[model samples]
Target: MPQCAIITCNNTHRRTKGGNVRYHRFPGDHNTRTRWLQVCGKTVPNCSTARVCSRHFSKECYERDVQHELLGLPSRCRLKKGAVPDTNLPLDFLKEEVLPGSAIDILLAVGLVPSQPVQKVSGGLPRE
Candidate 1:
């Protein structure tokens, strides 16, 4: 679950207002352009925007976001018993799969790359 928090300042130190916080679940890459825009609401005219996480966004100011960002997760920490699968598989396995070369093609098609580099490493591909 992706969480969102609205920053607020009370009499003392600022904090994330639980009332304004919300959670969302997405079915795609978090960093994808569409994903960010979908999660981060439209920016108010002349207002600033910042995303604390993939689905949580703090707009207009950073204080409110910081309150929760610096703190811990929402009240309930771990997932409830039997709430979700207990598989130990990496998270990536659930995301849409793309062929290795397709990524390069997509990157180039998007003008992110004009050309691919072929580097010459010492000693038959230097050891990592």
Candidate 2:
């Protein structure tokens, strides 16, 4: 049985009488893999042997066709590009940690910066 890669998730792709659960491998592309790692707050070595289960993805991540729905075909098993695991995470996962001198801190170091108000012109666009 393959277990989910997410540290907070415990869904295992085990065989069952009704059907077997599905797991997806981490993307091979550097950018995509980086995004996955960043979202999971995990490193490469930790995720090298890990796989995320389909339950982690949103319904949009899987493909569904009208015909398939009519015929009662199984939902598509493959994950779409840019699909991020969004389920079975710990509550703490929703809380982002702000480290000292982090980007947000740097941006707020000088206190709140005021935004320039948009000026409307006759052309229906803001003047530069």
Candidate 3:
């Protein structure tokens, strides 16, 4: 997934010049980056266009993936020792890549980790 330099506010009515929003020519029906097309053999209305599958994907899935990635970033210990983090890898790849007790659920399941701290809406360390 591509990380954006700007973070958008949660309120849609409030507009700003930042967020992960982007524009690319996507297939009209798809909402994800999957390599498969919606129609098995039938081509898209426009010939010679390949697109990520959007039909099966929902906004919730996207959000879940995003949350998983965000949570995973701080959980991975290998990145804490001043090494370059592997957070750049694809979310699917990260899910499949095996490292012992590295997954969030697994870490919690074996009682090897504590719950993540709750996020506050405001008033913490001043932004640098």
Q: Estimate each model's TM-score.
A: 0.20, 0.56, 0.18
Cα RMSD, each candidate: 17.6, 15.0, 20.9
Cα lDDT, all candidates: 0.34, 0.70, 0.33
TM-score of 1: 0.20
Q: How many residue pairs clash in each candidate?
A: 1, 0, 2
On lDDT, the candidate that comes out on top is 2
Q: Give the clashing pairs for model 2.
A: none
Off by over 4 Å in 3: 1-21, 27-93, 98-128
Per-residue error (Å), model 3, residue 87: 8.5
On TM-score, the candidate that comes out on top is 2
**lDDT by residue for model 1 over 1-128, one digit each (tens)?**
22322132021112433444333232234344343343233432221233232112323212244445568644332222222221222344335675466776878777897554566577667433
Q: Which lDDT tens digits does candidate 2 get at residues 1-128? A: 66766766666655422455677888877788776776564554755676877767878776656676789986557777767777666555656775578665766786866577899999999998
Report the alpha-carbon TM-score of model 2 versus the true structure. Answer: 0.56
lDDT of 3 by residue, 4-74 (tens): 21121122312323533331233233333222222222334542342222222334323234454767752
lDDT of 2: 0.70
